[model samples]
Target: MARPAVRRGAALGLGMLWWWAVLRLAFAPGAGVLEAAVAAGGWGLSVLPVHCVPRAQAAGAVGPERWRGAWRAVRTTTASPLRRSDAGSGPW
Candidate 1:
């Protein structure tokens, strides 16, 4: 648990560093709004894989049962009210 948490923290730290770099590059003198927007978008897309590493680590650490339970909770929280009503409960 601690190990995965540490890894997740490290990944998040790295992601923040990546964001810092993107912001620096995006805001550098002579950078246009379109150019900065493109740079930020590209950086966000690239960092997505890094974000997934933490989730993967956490799921692996928790094992299937607990991960499933967590996933259920997430689904319940995110599900549309109409969908929940149609199902008569949260998604399994």
Candidate 2:
């Protein structure tokens, strides 16, 4: 349907914009590895709420429940590496 096509187009457009922004920041003057990594991480964190809110709403969550679900999702995702129990597995 046209609606689906439009949604896909919008998603692609946003993705391209995000890619361009990341590239610009990564290559900016005086930007090093740490700066690039921090920028990328911050961008990812900022987008998390956008993704989480929609998913929570789709699941029929409301108000505080929606936010709680989002927070839980974020916490689990970010804590996954730290929660790993494998031996000799450092923060790397």
Candidate 3:
């Protein structure tokens, strides 16, 4: 189904919510970082308005090749296996 309109509406609602958050913080003194974050998250959740936003499926079934490729990339950048000599290398 075409969802351009739905996406646009959601974006507009989010923008309005962000504006509201700014206004709220401006008017309410002593509203700290945590309070602002909660206000923004709550507003974002309300803007969705749908019971369930359907997730787009993967292109197709995942296969062993995908798994192997993922593992290879992960192994390349990560630290190598720790030998016995390195037992106390890290901070306690």
Candidate 4:
């Protein structure tokens, strides 16, 4: 219950933060799609939940060891037969 809310809040909050930085502000004065994407990726990896991200990036704010157990669950699932094509289907 509360956990899902928290994760959603984190996702929405960080998503706006990232969008503002990459689009509204001068996150990259003259940068193009690639740089904006990379910056967004970095922001996501550092704060957003593992499930909110896509297949391209790694897990956690720092790394796998630092990420919560949920990350491990998703990682293991993504590799198993129970794996879901949708990245958002990570363990809840």
The candidate scoring highest on TM-score is: 2
On lDDT, the leading prediction is 3
TM-score of 1: 0.32
Query: In candidate 4, what are the lDDT values of residues 1-92, reduced to their tens digit?
Result: 99999999998987776776576436447667765775678676878564666534746345545466656567433554655677666666
Over 1-92, each residue of candidate 2 has an lDDT whose tens digit, in order, gives 89999999987876666666577676777646665665576578667755454644576656787778988876434444545566676677
Q: What's model 2's lDDT at 68?
A: 84
Model 2: runs farther than 4 Å from truth?
30-92
- lDDT (C-alpha) at residue 36 in model 4: 70
Candidate 1 CA-lDDT value = 0.67
How accurate locally, in lDDT, is each candidate?
0.67, 0.67, 0.71, 0.66
TM-score per prediction, in order, is 0.32, 0.36, 0.34, 0.32
Better of 2 and 3 by lDDT: 3
- Predicted candidate 1, C-alpha RMSD: 13.5
Candidate 1: residue 9 lDDT (0-100): 99
Give candidate 3's error at residue 59 in angstroms. 24
lDDT of candidate 2 at residue 53, scale 0 to 100: 47
When summed lDDT is taken over every stretch of 10 residues in candidate 1, the lowest stretch is 75-84
